[model samples]
Target chain A: MTVKQFFKSNAFKSLAVLLAIVIIAGGLLAIFNDLLFVSDEERFNRTIEKIYGGSATVEETLTITDENGTFDKGAVSAAYKMSDGNYLIHSSGKGGYGGDVYLWVVVIAENGKFGGIEKVLLDTSDGETLLGNFRDSFYENFTKHNDELVEGKYFGTSGSDVINNVVTGTTLSSNAMCNAVNTAIDFFKSAVLGEEVVSYTYLYEKYVDMTQTTIERDFAANSVTLRIVMQANGIAPSIAFDVTVKDGAITAFEATKPFVQQYDETKIDESLRNGTYFVGKTAEEIAAALPDGETLDPAKLEGLGLATGASRSSESFFRAAAFATANFEAFFAPENLTYASYVDFEQSTFTWNYTEGNEVKMHIVMQANGIAPSIAFDVTVKDGAITAFEATKPFVQQYDETKIDESLRNGTYFVGKTLEEIAAALPDGETLDPAKLGGLGLATGASRSSESFFRAAAFALSNYTFYLTGGEQA
Target chain B: MNKYVKTAVDGLITNNATFKLVLGTCATLALTTSAINGVGMGLSVTAVLLLSNVVISLLRKVIPNTVRIPAFIVIIATMVTILRMALDKFLPDLYDSMGVFLPLIVVNCIILGRAEAFASKQPVLDSAIDGVATGLGFTAALTIMGVIRELLGSGSFFGIQLWDFKIGFFTSSAGAFFVYGMCIALFTLISNRVEYAHRARKARELRVPAEGPLDAPGISAKEEA
Candidate 1:
């Protein structure tokens, strides 16, 4: 392309504009970054204030890893090599209860072996869910754990207070803190001891399942415990269970994971009977019994009711038993029933797609991109610009549905617009103010309908990164 | 509509970035847990939006259309970096609460949204007002949502615990949804009622002139006899 043509060309125009903007923006940002940046010591001292309630001197930053992998439990901050021959590290794990759990843990290094954790501070910056008596007493137990202590009391008010092997007042929230502490301990084992990390296909906080069954020869009892979590709806809250197998016979079966029941008690009483019926049955017999694919006949399930939702969940149990029987004979028995490195069940899933009847653009639905769990949306785009999305669904604070709905459908203001054009659409000669929004006294005031509109637009744009032809899915 | 009045109204409520436009959601959803936090985030955002809008309006003629998005982004980012660092040094509590979202303001759609749509086409004076107006709208929405969430979730107005009674779930994401929905509903209801009242009053005034005191020549032309 000629020099003159290049300036007019889309490629050059796009690139030149981008580069010029980058240069100017980057130069200024660098200076601000330097000026705004806090020194490591100050940052550490602040974290230490929450953790130790005293000033701490961070010696240096260090990296640790082993055979399984580097310590990937959480994001570990500076290693404060204290005067007491201890290293204080601040770490954050993604989830325990509702949000993240940040902790300050002190570890001691002994002659190249994994030293135990000395102190742990559960940073409540993002808060934790604690209710009732244990709310005050839970942290006291954590404070009781010092470096040399091996056995510590699992804090819980009652026997039923424990959830997913975590003993605490609240199941999910308190368990998150437990997981954070365990992550710190695991990091010590992997980094300091240089021990080979446990290799497994799946990992979870509550329980671990070996990819294959580890069959054991008769000793005490020729039995293996298997944990399987599944639910009817693809996005349904998972239902976790542990099925014990002894000599190819299903012995013990219980739902160990923390979850509220979807099926009523009567249905559970009737459906869970599938467990007893399958006991002493071979994997071949169990597999032979199942119809294959997503459907299984309840009549074939021996008096199990298909009308209630219990049968579907019960099928999850039988499926686990069958997989166990086959894999049991394959590896667990051959290895003399020895398996430790557990892996999680990573069930493969694909996006749910749809094409509205007689519509030009495609529509796809997915979960909303926030902590608003279970909330979902439908994104419809034509010629790359978003047409609209159904934002008032699943859950929302829709004050005026009619107005919000009207504004959402009126996204044509962004028709054929580039993502750039769509993002910035302020009117001409308008000196806008939040207070005077309704003051313009138009038919409608500051409309969240527009925000919802753009949210759908932005969501649709993001999905463009993972595109597929529009068609109906069976 | 009067152009200046319309613009200010639009910024605050008509086309608000937070409640209306839905831009800069990262900060809105993450930071608006308390009233002070909402105001703090709002000021920080206002600073960037005002400066970015002014800068972009001045450079509007110099910059090319094809590269407008990038140019706007660059300007916004610089402004955000400055705001972020300045806040970190001066207002550490707000800075700590905001965390990673401090830097994330660069990507906030509001700043760039204005730069591309308003500042680029409008004069410097108008663009500055647009920035402040929109910033205020964002601040208002956040503060209101924050107030609702904080009150219900903590049973306290602004960290002063009024009672032991608190809905712990309200402090979580699920709670945010409920509070956000309710706030939006209340905001729209009150705003619409006032707007409707104004329209009704205007219509009455117009009808009065048309009624012509019930004895004007327009209505009593034949009755003049």
Candidate 2:
């Protein structure tokens, strides 16, 4: 065919049209890509707000590599330095029942005790895994466990906590979650705290010694009982404290042991300063006042100096106080309460019946905030006196099992107390009013969890319907 | 229904790519692990479908019949590449979640089938609507299947837990086949019933014109009594 005939041929026409379309489409796509592209900084900035809820800047991103080849795809992939001087590490958690799951953990950079985790946001995960944890607010339970971390204590958890055990038939998924968190914590310890980034996996292993720390919930008083018995990494004594928390408030911040001091310590007590330390101060106040690093705020330490060579004992007291603050704020968060988890949070007193062995079938009641079907706590009342209290599977995961075991043994606080007495004793929002709580000489040691009975009492009084007779009651 | 609307409805229901036409079976069955995942895959397909249809319809007059298949494929592949990049930049989470499915859109028989059967002859407007309807139909099918699989298999609705109950069987690829089969059976059953009812209604109208024309077969009639 002639050149003119070829130009008019169908083959030539098809090639020309196809080539034209490809070029035009390519140009258009490139333009769209440019217009719609989100830089890593911008993408992280937007995602960070969904997590933290305020404006924050990305300071520096610590790239994640599968260095030791430990995890599947999860690692603290990026660390952004925020404009507000806070650090948030974006980590990925892999290996769910299905495959890979991802999340972002925000580290609250406090000066002392390795700036702990402030919030955990499950960004993207397998649908099954998310359903099992998300709707139930089970991630809150995971982050709550982080509060029990006393850097000075024996390393990190061995990873086989009971809470990790009962995460909806997906323990491997839970392990992935714990590994992701540990990755971020390790990054924080090395990058921020400047400590040796120890590599003790906190999941899929037996805790170094699970028995060393206790974070029991006082079922009777609706309080968090803390009994930390462990030797320190530094000069601090083998410290112990029975820190008490009720309704996100500290009622008892007393050191069950002596507020460790080596030699004659400069007293911040009477005749010296009014707003000094310990007795007059709340744990939250002390925690808030505590500095981020080894040094206490010079002003707060005005009269009392870390007596020369007595830094261990003094610093230990400060660290204990920080932990007490975190335990109250993190452990007793209203989200932990089953009653507060229902839609009718104010009036959510749903109950189920549980039959005791060779005994009357008693009704168990729980309070909640959101409409989630799972209630956090269940209380049993036999003949108007409380008997047994059970926190649901998800809620139980929020505290250390050893602590709950210890706290539950004090069932005497609930076994005999009337519903009214239990309600009255609940730490009045944050103030510990033992008088309202039946003022029984329950133990001289401040086990911090003394008020759990009140939670039992409050649930019973609101849910139990005795005056109406054999009616179905929660 | 007007011609444009009918074209759309036809694409969405009568000639749905994943069900009736059975095109793009692999991606439909694979990416539908969650409700949102199904939607994500569906929307991506729709975007590519719409763009490709418009281009192919626009170029139909210039391409020869003998070389049209390769020409159409080239054009479709270009659109697919552009779409893949746009999705990656704009919807990174969706991009990651979709994994390999976005690039696989090029092989989706639905796109080429429409180009060959309809776009080559239809007007640009009609082709675009066809693309949308067909994409929507594919999306609707996948999403419904995803909803069933996600809800029954994992006890979740759109990645959110309604309860902690799972059937286990629905989460597997075999489970995808089960759900897909049930959906096709259900769709065919309903369509057959509607077709049967429409024919019956037409017969009834012929028997008695006094009542009126039957227009409830998902069609709105402008006829007057």
Candidate 3:
């Protein structure tokens, strides 16, 4: 076609129209983009307004560096001192169930010290599928227990006692959230407040064999004081004592006032209450002082140069003393101490047994929260399909145990499904799909226990496929 | 009645974007999780639809037919981007709550569908009316669905806790489907009955005789008499 004809053709008209529209649209958008542009400072002020309920100017941009100390689970990325005396910290928590969780934390500052967490908002996250499962109250928990968090009382180094409001199904995410807030708190203490960072010595109930309510350690003096509460059998009131250990020996043993008031005064021995015979004894001597089966005969108590009137009370005292001595040594001895937070797949064990007629039985023990062994199960696989699945040790946790047990112990959830199919149901590094989990009869409410069950099943299936059937390892 | 009024009525009721035409069901289902979300999303869409329809209608004669789709998309996308910026600046809470879906308004069939089906052929005045009517229709439908779902699923109405009783099923995607299906079914039943009554009344006004039984599709016995 000629040049004149080409310019007037339908193709040229279409191209001209599209080009004109694109230029006009782009121009208009560029103008509006400038008009409605949200600058970083403006965005920060907006977030502050939303969280703090009023806008404030930036007082200073605080610097976060290695001098603040390194955090294993998370780090502080940005910090800003607000004109209203609050510090806004942008932080991220690692080791989430899915990946990292990013958060914008507003730390309330008062008189050049950490006040509390004003608010915590999720800025963005990387592949945290179950992030939406958390409610607003979950974030509010940080603000609720700000003082405890600053003192490193709740989420300590040992990770035994986390926040009470940890969501049932999202333990890893909850832990990540705790780590993120703790990072902010730690940075505020070390960098802003110029104070020594607080560290906790957590001891689990399983290892201690008694409830260590409160523990205080004096490293300079090489002594530890702990209160142990033991629930007595039947309707008798629970007994409590404040036991102090100095250089691996019990130095002081005194019953709490509540224990003294509740216990029968006539039957109790003054020597036990006053630490007459139990003082200056080690854990081994303490254990030897108590008779076998936790019952000391009155005659034996007298023969051991101890008060004989309160034999039952003496037995309780000796047992508490033994636990106190052991826990104190464990606390000071780094080799014997096992931090609950460090529990992972390495602590888990998987063993398999083969029955007659092509049936293979696998036993798996796994930890739900890395605090302790939470679940153990046996799966019988025949021809690659799970024939029988039973909970050798039923799933248990601090909360939601009954629902978790009911869901985990339901054999029909796993039976009649092939090992590969069960294994493929849960992909690696992704949060559990609630719908798929529902199809597999896993309760989303009991997510931690369900996750433990899933990990155990995956472990069993991988082992059954690789070791028994000679398949390649996953 | 005026033709413009009739067109507006048609857009609002007969060609409702959510229930009748089933356009923009993605936003309808996704954002109807709460009444406030529904209202916020609905208003955002309405703003986009109204602006895009007017602009496209004005440029219809100047733009060629072959490149209409892309041209229409450019206009709609521009409008959506502007809406997003304005919301982010003025109403950050709504912007945060709407999240990705706020930007996804560009692809919503409601805007493009009206541009091609009505705005591209109609005058500017009529297209503007149609846009408002259709937008309001979608908002109404979403609000209704939001109320039902929020009440059933979250036991709240527009974020106010009425009671703690809730059926969590209503909050899931499956629940959205269920609520959408039920809303469509109920809307169809009610609209169909109203349409039949109006047609019978019109025939009576025209003094036309029924060719079949009164209960037959459009005419009733009383109107025939």
Candidate 4:
């Protein structure tokens, strides 16, 4: 058709009308889009206004930096100094029941120092389905115990008044919320107020059987003094020690309370009571110096140049020193540790056997958390990814072993996942990402045992990568 | 009644978007998790429907038949975008609750259905009335379902905790389907009865026989009278 004829045709009219409508609609939308835009900062300010009951201008946006490398529980993502002198911190807490719990904590400033938390608002959550269980009063508890919170007292710990008010069904989310608030407070203390932020010594309680009562850090001396209380186990009475560690070596070890035999008053051997043998040894050296077995036999004590007469007393002292050393390493040099550190690597084994085709099957036996009768798994790998995982020996922890075994036996969670993907699926610490776990077909309730399975999978994958693929072993 | 009023009544009861015509069931089923969500979605749809219908009705003769569908869609999508932007800026809570379903209003069958079926053939005023009536019908239906589900599933009314007792099954997608199916059945039954009664009343008012034939095989009109 000629251009003039086409212009007069019905099809040409239809095209013109449609294009006109498109242009009009697009133009109208552009105008409205510009008119109704809500920027991120504006949205945050609105949220602040809603929570604080008044509009406050942003004085300045603060950059968040984890300077001390101690932000494991949670970290502040953004901070803002409001015109009203309140610091609004956007923080995320790890170890939530589902995943990370995000929160907006407003730290009220008074006299140029951290006053207390003004209010905490739940910004968002990953998979915390039971957030409804927490009421306004539960959050109000934070404000109620503000002074203690600023003084480095954490909720869910003994002697903290906030522990009593933690919501029952949503403990993980509650803990995560507390962590988020604490992270904000920690930032306020160190960055805002220029006060020394002390790390919690209670964090080291997980690495040892003994309780770390107090930890005093001498930053100038590059040393820490830990006071620990070893609980009475078997014939050993409860004993307390002042263990000082510097440069990863034990500088001082003194029994604050003398070791007394139960129902007997006998002077303990000098070598056992003095703690001089362990003064210069590091954690690895002390761990190596100890004789094998739960109880050091008389012959073994004699071999270590210890008087065998105080065998039980010597055993208690050495065990306490060993636990103190473990705690020191865990607190100071956490990078050197892994899930394998807690597991009895000597008892655990990883074997990669040849399979038909290119697939390789690995058998892993891991004994963790001092649980006897190691748990074992047979994993199949192809192209650096897990193809199948089956529990040959079920996890025999205090948890529901049957349910754990059933979930692990399903094993599709790890089937298509590579070593890095599996490791990144869950958080480093105790927090398990429920959304990721659900996507992987792992049950959140069986998280403790699931972690064991994950460790096993990691071990198998690392071995397969190292032996079969000539990759670096994790 | 005025023709405009009649058209609106018919849109609401006889040609209801949710229960009668069974259109826009996606938003109805998904967003009726709470009564507040139902109101928000219904009103948002109403605003979009009203604007799109008016625009389409005004341009009905100007647009050619071959490209009417695409033209209607572009108009409807524009209206929905404007509505979304307004809601996000002014009413963020409702916007967050509506979530992805807010944008999906662009393809909602109710707006497009009215544009094609009613607005294309009707006057601008009648088309606008039909939009409001149909949207209100949708709103009523969604609100009823939301009330039932929220009451049973969460034991709450519009986020107010009524009681702790709850049947968790009612909060699931399957529960939404069940509620939707039951509402459709009940609405059809009631509307059919009302329509039958109204027709009978109208016939009686005009002195016409309700059911019997005017002429029988053995009887003439005079004999039947």
Candidate 5:
């Protein structure tokens, strides 16, 4: 049929009717679409306030259209908010597991320090891979370091002790989040702080009741239990007190939780058998091994490990040891004259230095801040006193070059090698040794699988800290 | 009753706009996604169809044949626009759901076809009945297709769940084509059979002997005697 004849036909006439109807309907719709626009804007504002933890203003709002941007009617929009009060801000520099790096600005002000992260959202679509681990670990990191930040330190977590660092194949996402927080900090300093030369203080408060003060001295138990609560409020509310006997002789003193030095050496020695450290060694031997001179510095001892690449494994060990020592001091130290019982943090290691075989007496002290207590192990070296020696903990032994080669060439799991062991096995001309792998294990031929394992391990280690500190018993 | 009313009803049901006449296939396909949508579209078209048919019938004597097509189109457009606004304000959901199909009804072959054919020759009441009956038939056909499609494709009847169902095959665009094919095949078969039976009956009634069968027989008998 001719086109004109077809158009004039009854069937075509009906088809034309339907099309005409739809056109009219669309025109009517275009007229009322404006009414919904206002409601959508209001909903967006409320969502921003709820999600970003503050009131946000819409400086500019416009309808989304093609060729302008990628945003759609339902797509998210960007906005900014300003603080209502004074806040203390500090930066968190973290080396995420598997060589990922992150930076963040933790703000603590008004109510408390590390006032938790004001906002943490993935700004990069490419960084979506890190979402599972980074998002999971965020609140936990805040909780773990809140008090520490309040005390003026940016504590870093290592291994499973912090939140999972190697998020499900999303190292880039981790970096993006780190960058976002860093950007926020830079933005705050430049736009908010702005060359203002002023001094700020962090306030702490302690509440104490004299009527409720009780001191129990158990001579036979070689311990004392002193229960006291103190409250003080000021610009910086920390209160330091020294509890002394009536004759002015110091009995026992503690700050917040008693430090390592405040513990009675004899009582600590007696209680040594019960600590996690004495699980492998006898109490008498462990007490005897306690260095009489200054503690061995972990930073210096790291130099003794096999050198490879940049010495990441050695650095990790030193860091792990420092965190372990801090944990040891926090939980097990005595309170007042009486030695108070505390939870055993067994996931870390401790080290000290002493002279042996006439070599210059070594004094070492380790200070790792953000690893679990279980991963900690001690290594003792005496000059010419002992022949060849192995790592104090088999799990912490450094792998030799042969072991590293086997792992790299054969794709075997490098389970127990320490940084020194891995470092010694670097191939000639290779810039990075296992020590420099940054908490990642060598599975060379099986890089992908090894990377997955690293990510999983990092996640597990980070989760462990949160699980323990959540104060919930499983 | 008037012979014209009966003629229109018989024409619409037996020579239906969809089944027999096949006048408005576009509206049928475009709007038959659900029974509710099809009915709304059907009724709106029906109103415009009735009004336009009557106007065309009333003006048949006055209007010259040269401008008849243009005159019919203008009338249909005016009626469709009014209906569109009314639907938008009162039955917004249907209006939205009908979408562009609502306005497109102005060009429907069924309405304009009747205006040009029966309405232009018939009286006002007869034209109105023709419009209503034909529109009703079209509505019925579309509603049937829509109901089947919606039920099979989405497990719903008029957008309401009839039963807890999990028919995996009906959940995609493929299901829509499947339903359309089946419905077309079924409706076509039914209409063909109905039309065939109707034509066969008419043929029998109109059948005539080739050469005066009785007179030829009588002559042959006489010659044999």
Candidate 6:
């Protein structure tokens, strides 16, 4: 039969054609549905990019739903910024305790500093303590400091306070946050900042002395050598000080290790290398680096080093130098300097002479880095010969605990002994008697035990004035 | 008009499309998870079914006798397509939730069965009445199923939480099946008794062995050529 005849003959043929059309159409629609809806991973990646300012190409993105088949997108949305920054920097983290609690987080970063944190959406309904409390605790901080959204610096308070864990609740979460922000800071500084900033010191002092001479040296050229001496009679022990180079250009500086026996070696070294830079050809050349129209402080020189990338260690060293300079001024040029009373000076000298006839003397001088406004000293030399010298000031000991302990424990305790001097007297374990306290009339001793030494020293020092006075004074 | 209204109302509620007659089980079971969802699915199917019935009735004479089912399906499917597009644009959420079941409404037994049995034989208005009654009844039954499922399982009446009780029997898939079975059984019991009573009274009044099969409510007898 012909095709037209076949169609005309049977109604089943028409039904067959109709069924065929429907099957084709429905099949086409089913195919279309699969294409339009994106897989879950793409959405997660996009969200992560928004928060961290970087792309996160995660391998897997799991869509979580509650028992009610509803999800809170807002809670998950908070993770966008933190994961991109620093801290919880793991590519991924396993959740706590159960299969239910799936959490991931990253420390918050902005403008190259660790500020806050972000956590991926968590699907924990079990109400378990460790994971649930951690999540809750984290949200609590995020909400409280939610207002303190500074661009950088993770902890709401500022600086090292970022490392402080949540006090009473969610200690685990608090520790986690601390870990994340700390990691972020390290990553940002090491990976992003790319330089170590350091600081240096320059100090000068003038005093009324029998010997008259002018001294000059270049610090950046490494031609200058600094030595500090101490004397008793200070207003405050360990008073804050700074040594500002009023003028000088810092042409260049390379790190140098201090003597093993030196006082405050770690702190001084750190200060020198990490503090702010003042660059120029002379002491006066460096002061121009201060903020415009701001006066440089000879006491608080380290404060200037707080700028971004400033070397903390170098700034601290410069501050120490500035203190020394001011104290030296109080002793040498007592009338020339203000804010400190006059003190005596002792002198010593070094020779730079080549011949007897055309000899030149290089003077090596030690002045007080006057953290304490007490003893001051100087050194003098002329014509390649040692010049007359005397300690016009009363004896001064540097009051460092190490020196006192070294001397007292070795039975060689003396009133005015410095660490260098006491090192010569110590004989291992022999304890000094009270009778040996002679000249200074004080038996400087080590702590009763190493544990309480600092506290005891602080207590003794705080009540020194009261002790000096009789019971009547109390 | 009075007889027509009575027939339509009785067909619509008394012999519901899903419960009493147990027709269109595929769409009924697939879409009834909530009252809103059930209504949306039911109304969509109703619009398609009624339109197809009216058009089929008007063209019954013109349609060649041999290829009637194909022509009827084509008309019904076309109407379903129109409903699908309209629902997609206007009530997208319901359209999405209904998924493939909305298109399946064309092949629904209630619609096809009526088009072949009633619409093909009756006038356009009568056919339209049958379509509405059947579609509304189907909608009502599915909506009840949806309401029961949502309330028992989620402690919610259509997404609004009512209470949370740990009555395991009520809040489960088994519970849904149980409820649906009970409803169908109850409908069968009530309708069967009603039919029996009506039959007994009619038989007694007539005092004969029945003139024809027309006296029966649900049972149908095939006529020979």
i-RMS, every candidate?
6.8, 6.7, 3.9, 5.9, 14.8, 13.8
TM-score each candidate: 0.50, 0.48, 0.55, 0.52, 0.33, 0.34
Clashing pairs in 4: A95-A431
How many clashes show up per model?
Answer: 25, 42, 0, 1, 64, 55
Lowest lDDT 10-residue stretch of candidate 4 chain A: A203-212
> TM-score of B chain for each model?
0.88, 0.90, 0.92, 0.89, 0.78, 0.81
* Cα lDDT of model 3 by residue, A1-474, tens digit: 999999999999999989999999999999999999989878776667767676676789987786663565578888888888888888777656767777788888777877878888876554554443354657877788777665454442222234455655457777677777777777777788888874422322322213224454454467877766655623334567888899989889888756333765456667777877778887656645543324444554545544444555556666677667755655443221112122232323222222244455655545554333466667776656677777665433344556664645766677777655665656652234556564555544676666666655655554553323222232
- Cα lDDT tens digits, model 1, A383-415, are 455555444343333344454334344444444
Better of 3 and 4 by TM-score: 3
TM-score of chain A of each: 0.34, 0.33, 0.39, 0.43, 0.26, 0.22
DockQ of each: 0.18, 0.12, 0.25, 0.23, 0.01, 0.02
Runs in model 4 with CA error above 4 Å? Answer: A39-41, A55-61, A65-77, A81-86, A91-103, A107-474, B159-167, B202-225
- Kindly report which residue stretches of model 2 are placed more than 4 angstroms away from their true locations once superposed: A1-14, A55-77, A81-86, A91-104, A108-111, A114-144, A147-181, A198-474, B1-5, B77-99, B150-174, B202-225
Task: Provide C-alpha RMSD values for all models, in order.
Answer: 22.0, 23.6, 17.6, 17.2, 25.4, 32.1
CAPRI classification of candidate 5: incorrect
Return the top candidate by TM-score.
3
Question: How would you encode candidate 5's per-residue C-alpha lDDT over A188-301 as one tens digit per residue?
Answer: 333344432111110010122222323332322333233332322222222223231211122343333241122222222222212232223321222222222112233433
lDDT of 6 by residue, A157-273 (tens): 111113233523334333344333333333333333443311111122111110212122222232322222211112211212222332222333323233112233333434344
CA error at residue A311 for candidate 4, angstroms: 21
Per-residue lDDT of A258 in model 5: 46
> lDDT of all predictions, in order shown?
0.55, 0.59, 0.70, 0.70, 0.42, 0.44
- Chain A, model 2: TM: 0.33
| Tens-place lDDT digits, model 3, residues B104-131 | 8999999999999999999999999999
Candidate 1, residue A164: lDDT? 24
Summarize candidate 2's per-residue lDDT along B151-225 as a digit string, tens digits: 998788998888888887776678888999999999999988888778766766674565444554533433321
The true-versus-predicted C-alpha distance at residue B83 of model 4, in Å, is: 1.2
Candidate 1 has an lDDT of 0.55
